[model samples]
Structures are given as structure tokens and as C-alpha cells.
Target chain A: MSDTSRTPTEVDDAALIERARREPEAFAEVFRRHAPEIQRYVTRRLGADPAEDVVADTFLAAFRQRERYDLSRSSARPWLYGIATNLIARHKRIEVHQLRVLERTGTDPVSDPFTERSDERLSARSVRQRLAAALASLPAGHRDALLLVAWGGLSYQEAAQALGVRIGTVRSRVNRARNKMRKELGGVDPTSSISEVHVRG
Target chain B: MDEMTQLDRLRSEIPTPELSGAAERRLLAEIATSSQPRPARRQRRRVNLGLGLASGLAAAVTMGVVITNGDSGDPGQTPTVQPYSMAAVTLQRAADNTSKQEELHPKPGQFLVFESQTMDPVDSNNENGHSRFLSRSKRTVWLPVDGSSLDGVLFMEVLPPKPYPGWPLPPEAKQEVGTRGPDRLADFDQRAEYLRTDYAYLSSLPTDTAGMRKHLYLELEPGARADYEAWDRVGSMLAEGYLPAAQRAALFRAAATIPGVETVKKSEDAAGREGVAVAMVSTEAGERQEYIFDLKTYQYLGQRTVVVDADKAEAPVGSVLTATALLKVSVADSAPVVNGG
Candidate 1:
């Protein structure tokens, strides 16, 4: 094993990208450092069937454009993500359908959908479905901003950099996405409350 | 639980993806060969020179036999997905419409609002093992446009349509969405609904169809794996993302260059909005996806897809698999937010 401290994980990503430009082989460090997380990220969106392809394409595209990489940015997360998002756009239909199904059934066909809990309210299931439908209902741009922060783990500035948009766009999109989902997260449907359900029970 | 807390709970519930030894090794090896277009010459020199310093270090890096997905067996080449193209007239009209759009720049603190709908097919087991039907939901969004602000553009919201289903949201949390499901940003975490790029980037796109087609085609080169299917990407770039009028027009015109172009006289977007459609079919996938434009102005209305040959795919022959309607895009004073939405 090589020195852990000097491993690609320890080196700055921008430097690694630069090194790969010369050695070509050095790009492996980038794949090593990020592919797992990138896979998880894509799997969540497109399911396991296509996640691997997405990851491979993302890294390959990054490799092809390695020369254009902004060496000023130390982290490759945002840039990698930007490419991934554009790619995901190709699957918007599949994605929207999956999101809606997840919302309606309270389960994801891709990842582990929801924890099985017998005691949860049926209303809660509807709430989950509603939240998903709400997300599916959103414009692509807004959904991208909201998810980047919530799932992709990027900050507002980082997301903005990744999307090539101003920071406020991210902020507003998140806000808009949340607003649509806010109504669905309530534990019970507005038409019926715990007490109303109790009345029915 | 309060809404915000519930959202927080759901966000934390996402399972860590399963790991794959093969996938990891493939990624590293793929990157190794992908560094440059031509690797034979430099690879030889670098391997020898670098071998002296790193010696076993590079070999120790886990060289493996796995092939990267990009290297071969492209799913796009599958027979079902077919050759895609768009009508030249429709492309020219879309390009013309793009050229005529009013250039927009939001003042600081302004919000960009997007209104749209999402539709998809739902199938159930109750009806003789198949109950396939499409469902539709409407949405509205408010946003803060880009510009200098004391705090920054932080506010936006998605509102249910009028005569909303009469729902009461969580009072504790300001706002929440996709608290449970496939994350919209699950890919990399950079989020922005701002599809309309600034003037500079918009101006930089190739303004001619031939040039735009060449630029996009090169993206799938090296392998030269497929045919006009790359045109699907060019058309997608025009309809799905941000592009200025001139650029959008150029893209539509470029789309005209694609082979197998077709036009549907009458079609409906998700919102049940009727319009003419310019589209392409994937013979391999037994499906067709299209971009809808107003019959007269060629204004971009929405996008749609249908199952052309149901026998090859899972759904019925005429089922609308996916549909989206972009209702409005405009500048606003502020976005819908926490207490206000």
C-alpha cells in the first residue's frame, strides 16, 4: 500500500485533475475519491439499473474536459454534480414517473423506499405521496436547486457554482420547492385529522 | 411530528447505496484511459518514466480487467431506441420564435417564476394485472431573481393550483418538499431553477444549426458509436434547458439537420394544452419523445412522450408515458417563502 497521507484522497482534486492532464492515468485518483458517492447520488435519481452508467459517463466526461476544469476550484463535487444534473435531464420522464410512484406508494422503486412501520398513519403514507407528487410537480430548475442542498450536500454558493447560476437562484428555487412540499408533510390530510380519523375508527 | 422535523427525519432516512467492487475498479481504470483523446504515445513514455519513480505504486493501484460502461456496449445503440430526428420546418419556426423573444434581465432582488405540470403513467394490479393510466398534478413557483441584496435571493415557493385540494401544511416548518422520495438533486447537490442563463453564456452558444450540431455531435464522438440519435440531445438542449432566443433558434434549425424527422399535426401537452409537435422515435426503445410548439407562433409550449409500439415495451401502444407543460416564465418581486407561501 502506498502512503495513506499521500494517497489521491489526500491530494487536492484540482491538482489531481491537472496531474491527470499529463499522466492521463492520474485521473484514476479522481474516480477513486468520488465515484462511490456519485453512484449513490445517481442511483437515488435513476435507480440501480442505470446508476452505474451515469457514474461512468460523468467521470469520463469530466476526464474529457479535464483541461477546461477550473483549477481554482479545489473540490470537484460541484463540477461533477453539474454534469450529472445535465445528464439526469435526459431521464426527466423516468425520474418524474419514479417520484410520483414513490409519492403515491410511499416507496421508491430504486432505493429502499420507506421503513416498514405498522403503527404509522395511512394519512402519513398519503402525506409522503403528496410530498413526492409536489416535488414531481415542480419545474426542473427549482427541483435541482432544492435537491442539491437537501440530498447532494452542496451549499448554496457551491450549488450556484455548479449550476452556473447566481446564488439567489438556488435560494429561491429551494424556497419554491419547499413551499410546494410544505403542504404535504403535515401528518394528516387537511380533510381529516387524528381526531377525525379517530371518529372514523 | 412537526413538518420541518418530519422533513428532516425523512432526509436522514436515505439508505447508503450498496457498494460494488467491480464498479469501483472500473471507474478508476476508465479514468486512466480517458485522460486524453489519444493515449498510446504519451501513455508509453509516461508509463516508463513514471514507472521508475512510482514503480510498483502505479501497478499497486489495482489495475483490473473490468471495462468502463462508456468503452463499449452503449445502451443508446440498442435497436429499440431507434434513430431520432425532427422536422426542419418546425425547427426553423422554433428558431424564429427564439430570435423574437424579448431579452430579459431581472433587477436585483427580483425572482424568476416558473409554472408547470408533471404527468406520468400509473399502473395497478387490480385490473387483470394491468391498470395503466396517466396522472397529472399542477404546480406554481415564485422566486427571487438574481441581483445584489442585503441578504441575497433566499425566498421561493411552489404553490398548489387554485381550488387546491384544501390542505393544511405544517405550521412549525416554514416550507418543505420531496421530504420523502427520489431526490431531485440526488446527482450532485448543486441546485438552481434559473434555466434562463445570463446574456454572456447565451451569446456564446453556436448560433448556426450546422455549427451547433457539430459541437454537440463531437460530445459523442471518439467512439462514433451511434447515428442521428445525437440530434435528440441537441433538441433536448433547446427545449429542456436555458437558452436565449438566438441560441434556441439555432438549436431548432440544427435539429432540422437530423434524419428521420417527423411532425404530428395535433398533440396535447400534460396540461391538456393542444399544440403541434416536432418529434423523433426511438425504434429500439419503441417510443417517441417530442417538443410541442404553438401551431401558429411556434412558441414552445411543453414536451411529451408516447409508447408507439406497446408490444415491444411494457405499456399500451398509445399511452402517454410522460408529459410536461411549461405554462409561464416571468420576473417577480419576491418568491413564495416560509410564512408567506
Candidate 2:
């Protein structure tokens, strides 16, 4: 995070946001920097159709609220993610339904377009289905915390910031979500199953 | 094998999709539009005045006594005519012509769309200190029939700007030329009730000349300034507000009675349409505010503000401060949705 935040060619998101208040076109830089990451996060939760709209609204809402941004936060990742998470909460039904569909049918509507290799699909199917069931069964807050840490690649503190919760709350939710996933997988080592498929491949 | 690892692999194949062109355009458009400073509350009244300076052009002219012609020394010469009589004759003709035009009957849930072109002075204070230029735009506003300005939607295309007569064109002026919004028309509206131009309120206004005249003067303190305010109200109504023909006729007839109104033989709208105009001088501002009407049809063409006193307006006499052409008004079933939420 420190290294990415200090990339030589990059301007601090805080500086861009500050300049945007005076020169609004400067906001396009902030959008160009973060939109792809935010779009993928949204697409993973909801499907592609709604991701475009959600991402657009997230940046627009952030632009409107830019004046209130805290300049002390040099990186805008947590702030942008926070807005995207709130917007994703609006599509909770879609997220849960997609997860349940993947668990029951062994086909991921959210990822179908990107799964190019049949061998990769075959190897990951059982484990993927179990993971989907575990995810769908978790409470919304627990699910958000877990995904922010695992899929979003946010640290524990970053997940708490993104979710607007205390670090302690994020820690507990992730722990509880992990325990639920282990139970759903029947306490068996899924790696051994994957290793057998790997050898066959 | 762990839950976090399994979760990480879930939907992990989904690549970060590129931002679609349409979405990027929408964001860029919004940013470009929002960069233009919103008109302050007081400036909004000037916009409502339809003079186009409502964004930031300060009303610097001071209010002064109307200089009525006092000389009657030349009895042999044609009797000096009061400005009001000529203005009254033109307005009455407009009233008669308006009564015959087809009227729009917008329902409560519909929108009254107003499309117009405007050029007004924009004042910017930044690292360069104070600089001024003429900002021009083509705008379409969708105002809800029953709600305040807060419920309206605005779409504007910024045109290349011109220099504000003696002032150089500010560099920032060129940076904002492009399309913006189907966004909210206003952040908030704190207008007095009588000033509302919502179709619902306009439709309910008194449709008789006497009552309409009273409506224009509502809450105004009596004086030459009050008369100017009443005349200004007429400009506001004609600028963006739609009225049923009967009320429109009454408004025209009422406007004709404002104390200092005089008919200007020649005037041109922002779109360059030539017409006869009825004008009133704001003695304080040293400018003449004119509302042009088609010569034969008597239809309202547009409104403009021209400097009449060079020293007071701080511009050369005859220099135009603001001009607007209201191009079209129609009823729409809905406004365009830009938020995508």
C-alpha cells in the first residue's frame, strides 16, 4: 500500500480532489485512476449490467462531495471504496441471488464471461460451489467485511475504513465469516481435491 | 483450502472491465458543467429576470428618480407623449394577438420544457484576481409542472465565449465550452411564493388585467423602484414561465401600465430576430431593459439589457450587458434520467 501510494508518476488523490474543487475537469484524473478497480469490485458483487451504473454513480457522488474530503488522507482508495460499498449495498438482493444461483447450479453468472479455459472451470467447480453457499449464507455485513479483505485486497484496517466500521468489528466479522465457510465445506481439505485435479490436468 | 483463499478464488476470473465510453462521457460532461460557478441566490433573480446576467453580472446601477419630461414650452410642436401611452398601445395589441394563439395545457405530473440561448457577463476571481468575460450557452430546462426549482432538470451546451466589451476574454472562459447536465437545475430554492414560475402556480394566477397588475406588484413597496420591480416581474414571467393565453394577455396588458415603459422602435433578440420592444430604464443601473415582441404578430421574442448611461453602467452607451432568446416551450411527459440510479 505504501509503495503504490508513492508511485513516482502519480499525484496524491487528495491533491487531485483539492484541485477538482477549483478546476472540476481535474476530477477525470481521479476517475481514470480508480474506476477500473471499482468497476471490477462492483462487477464481482453484482453482474456487469449494473456495474457500469453503480461505478458511474459512485464517482459522481464522490465528485459532488469532494469539497468535504479530508485532505489528511493522501490516498483516495479507502474513500472511493467506501462510496462503492455503500452503493453496492443498494443491490444486496442481486448479490445474494447470484451467489445462491452459483451454489445451486455450479455456474457463476458473475464470472461466466471471463472463464476461458474448460480445465480451470472443471477443477474449481466443487470448491467454487461450496464457497458460494458459504458466502450467500453469511449476513450482509459479515459478507462485506470478508470480501473487502479477500477479493478487494484491502487490509483489516482498510476494510474497516471502507465499511465505516471499527477495526474490531471488521476483525470479528471476518473471523466469523471464515468459520462459517469452513463448516460449509465440511471441514475437509479442499486443496487435496484440487491437487488430484491438477495432477490429471 | 482456507475460507479466505476459497473466497478469493470465487469470481476471481472476472477481470477489471474498462469504463464504458458512455459512462465516461457522462462523468466528463457533469464535471465540465459543474465547473461553471452556480449563480448566487441574488444572481438567480437576475437569471429569472431573463437578462442572462443572473450568474454573476452584478446589478451595479443605482436606483434613481424617473426623469419625466417637464417641458411644455413649444405649444405649436406635437404634444410630448408620455412613454407609457406608446408602451400601453403595443402591449394591448400583444394582449389581443395572444388571445388567439393555441395554448398548452400541461398536467400536474408533466414537465414544462424551456429551451433558450443566453449570453451574459461572467465574473471570475481566482489566481488571476478579478477578470470578466461574456459566457454564452444554449440551455434546455425541464421544470416540473407542480414543483419548485429544486425539481427541475437542466441540460446546457456551453458555447465559445466573447469578451465583455472593454475586458479581455479570460483564459478560464475557454476551458468550459461543452455540454453539461441533465442534472438538477438548482441545489436549493428559497424564492418568495409570488415569484414561483411553476406551471401549477402560473395557471392559478389571476387572468384579468387588474388582478394581474396587482399580482405583479405584490409585496412591493410603492415607488419608481417598485414600478421597476413590477416590470422586472413581467420579464421573469415571460422569460421562462408559461401562462395560459388569457393570463398571458392579462400580463402583457398589466405590463403596459408600468410608469416608465416606452416603446423602442427597433430591437434585436439574442437569435438576431428584429422586433419592436417596450423598455423601462433602471435609473440606478443606468441601463434600459427591453422586452422585444414580433412587429406584426405581437408575440414575445426575447429580452435584453443595454447600457444607457455609460458612466453608471461602466460600459460604452449602447453596449449590451445581457441578451436571451427563449426558443421553445413545450410539455414533456418526463425529464431525462442522468443519475442512472
Candidate 3:
């Protein structure tokens, strides 16, 4: 059977588990690697304090439950993501309420205008407002799944795994969320070239 | 403030703080002393802690088994006990908002009761006696039949098991209780269900005046690591009942500022504890909402959770909330006594 011999990117999750079982300190290594990314993800969603709590909760929970890990998969992002997803669920009202307030008041907890070079992007508050409003209007599940894929850049399967749902569910949630967002954005078409510029890296 | 621009601007202004040194030390120290025994190694170590995030569920499973095995027995087995401080949980409701007077006036014999049900027997007395441990997903109320004077808060603390009492737990239930340190039962995830029940049942219990200090106290089951600092803001608002009408609105405004919440309803509790029932939903799906009843006319007694969600989120398809149910009782009725120990 294939073991831990795979490429670094392809290292199976089982290998990580096998190693963690032997070395307890190996758990901290996991946190060291993922903490930054997880921090970034959480910061993007819930701001600083709550994000910190969420990150801590995520890692602590992961550390506590490390023993039952299945080693079939290579990457642990999904598992970590799954735990984070659950934590995020616990704070949905704050997130939703914050988002709704932001939508109506045009407030962004972390939005910055100075860093961006594009004048069009900078000036397009109305467009961004519509987008934020649309995003807030979508139901909780859709928003989370879509953002995980879009912002966190997790793959469909990985996103689903993180969310503790099937891959098909992730796809549909994203699709539905996207559709609703598009409708709310005054028919702003995301598929077109102009929209492409807005989303470009 | 123009919210869109403000958000964008704020995002740029603040750099996310790196993991705090104090926090890291605290967390690492917790790991060092954790009661969870490492599983025996079958192979040479091939993985590093870099893989920490992925092992959460597995860790959860293992810890659950370990803690369960380690602690399992009759909850009443332990005889030695430590002294615990009795804490109170309170919620303000709609009637309390408007009346600015008494919400409940207790008659004779009926007093407010609060309880914190535990898997570990609180003491030999409670363990062996008539104390009841409400299940993780069930909550109910038993009001006094004799029109007893119903006043004050009734809080309950029902907590998941720990490896030892009043200390760090193994990793499994740590996140549920917020940290490795000892916590009251009211702060657990299961408290959400019980909180809802407390709100519903608080209506049935009588209040003192028409609207004096109107509020319900949902005492987190003992061992809950509640966000007390944050919840305290809500408490202060409920406490200041004598404030003028315009000032009272400020209290509500203060509460609205709390993050991640939705106002669910405004009505009288079963006991006629008139108040606003606010529901705070979690951003992530399947998390339980915290329902708060800010009551009028009743003193902020304590609160308790009668029930909590017991199944996996997916097990109950299309259901955002699990099958957790809750009920609240008066503290006078539920508080445990040690039989003159």
C-alpha cells in the first residue's frame, strides 16, 4: 500500500497520522505550519479578537482529537478546515449581523483604499457595496462554502471535507450563493471580461 | 460612517496581531500537563506537528474514548469534594425593557432555584441523593405546585466530563469548555439548548414587581467557560432599570452592538416575564443560536440549561438546530444541599 513516500504536496494524510501517533510534539508542528494561513482566513472573516479565539479553539480541538485521525488522505487542510467551519458556525449570528450591518451602512471592518493601484477599483464603492450586500443576503451555508473556495482557495473536495458535507453539496451551495449574489448585484454579470478585471489577482 | 469604505479602510489600518506570547505560553503549558496519555508508537516518527490541523477529528475521537474510559464509573463514586462558588446567569426581556419595575413577585414557599448538573457527582450528597442530571439534549421544568413565592434567578450548570475536577481536561472536551482550565457548566456548547428552555420557562415562574429589574438568568451549567466579560455588558444593561426611557434605549443599543446576533422576538415568558428574546446565530452553519430573554419586573435570578444538541450536524438533515431541548427551574428548588455536611 502507498505510504508516506509520496511527494511533499502529495503526502498522504495517513502518514501524518502515523507520525503524530509516535511523536506528540509533531502536533505543534502542524499548528506552526497552518496557524498563519488559518489566522489569515479567520482574520478575514471575524476580525482579530474573535478570530484569535477561533484559531485557538481550532488548534486546541485538533490537538485533543488527534488520535482518531484517519490516514487515508494526504493533506490535513480539510480536517482543520472542518473544525474551523464548526467554530465559525458557533459565531454565525455575529458574522451575519455584522455582514448585514456592513451591507446597509457600507462598512468594512478591514477594507482599505490606499493599497490598491487601480483607480476604477478604488472608486467603485457602489459596486463593492452591491457585492457586499449581495454576499450578506445569501444564506449562511452558501456564504461560508463559497468564501472558503474563493478566498481560502480550497478545492471543491477539500472544501466539502472541511465542511463535513459531500462534494456535491459544496458545489450546489456555491452555485446557489453565486446566483443569489449576482441577482442582488443589480444584474452585474460576473462572467464577462469587465467583471473579470474586478476579480483578477 | 460609510460602512463599505470604512470596512475597507479599517482592513488596511490594522495589522492582524501575531499569536500573542502569553497566549502561546498558556496553550503550550496546557499541552504539557494535559491528562491525555500519548498512544504508544508503532512506527518511527514520520510526521511533525506541522500536520496539527488535520488530526482534529481523530484527536477528538481518541480523546473522547480516553477521557470516557479514564473517568467512567458511577458519577457518585467520588466522596471528596471542593468548594465551588455559586455564579448567576441572567437575561433581560421586553417587558422589563418597557416597564422599568418588577417582573416577578414570589409568593410564600416558592423561591428561585438554580442548579448545575454534572456528570461527576458534585459531592457524595448530591451524587447519592435526589439530584438529577439532565441529558445532553433534553430540558424540562418542574414548578412548585403550592404557588410558592417565585423570585430571583435559577441557574444550572451541566457540564461534560473532565479527567479530574477543577483542572485541565484532556484535549477532547477542552474546546467545548473553551480552555483547559476549570470552567462553570453554563459555558458549554450544550448550554445553548438549555438557554432556550430557560427563556421559555422563565415566563411561567412569577416575577416580583410590575417591571423592577426585569430579566431572566440563564446560569450556564457549572464548568462552562462562558464569555462572561462579553455577557456582562448585557447584564449591566438589564440591571439599570431605573434609567429614563431615552436612556433605556441606549441599553438596547449597547446590546445590538454585540456581534453575530439576530433579534428573534419580543414577548412575555411563560411566567409573564415580559422581555425581548434575541437570537444570536453563528456565522457557520449548524451552530446553535443563543436566545436571551431580557425581562422586566423580575430580579435577575440565575439560569440553567435543561438540554443540548446530541447528534452530528448532518444526522438531522435540513435541521440547523439539533434535537437539544431545555427547561429552567427556580434556584431555590434545584440548588443542591450537602445534608449538613
Error of 3 at B336 (Å): 32
Which regions in candidate 3 have their CA more than 4 angstroms from the true location? Answer: A1-14, A110-123, A187-201, B1-24, B36-341
Error of 3 at A134 (Å): 2.2
**Decoy 1 TM-score against native:** 0.41
Candidate 1 wrong stretches, greater than 4 Å? A1-9, A113-124, A186-201, B1-14, B28-341
Q: Calculate model 3's interface RMSD in Å.
A: 11.5
The model with the greater lDDT, 2 or 3, is 2
Per-residue alpha-carbon lDDT of model 2 for A107-186, expressed as tens digits?
A: 78888877776456533666777788888999989998988888778888888877778999999999999999888887
TM-score of 3: 0.41
Worst 10 residues of 3 chain B by lDDT: B40-49
Model 3 over residues A76-174: C-alpha lDDT tens digits? Answer: 777787777667765676666666665566555533322344333432444455666766677778877987886666888889877767899999998
What's the TM-score of chain A alone for every prediction? 0.82, 0.90, 0.79
lDDT for each of the candidates? 0.52, 0.72, 0.39
Please give, for residues B1-341, the per-residue lDDT of candidate 3 as tens digits.
Answer: 23223224323333445655444543443343222222111000101111110111011111111112222222222112111110111223433354564334433344433221212111111111111111111111222323321211122222343332222333443333322212111111111221122222334323333222222223333221222223332432232112233334334444444434343233222122333334332222222232235444323321111111222221121111111111233324332221222
- The TM-score values for the models, in the order shown, are 0.41, 0.52, 0.41
Selected candidate, larger TM-score, 1 vs 2: 2
Which CAPRI category fits model 3? incorrect
True contacts kept of each: 0.25, 0.58, 0.03
How close is each model in CA RMSD to the real structure? 22.8, 23.0, 18.9
Local accuracy of candidate 1 as per-residue lDDT tens digits, B171-248? 211222222111111111111112123333444668877787675565344321233345445433432234666677
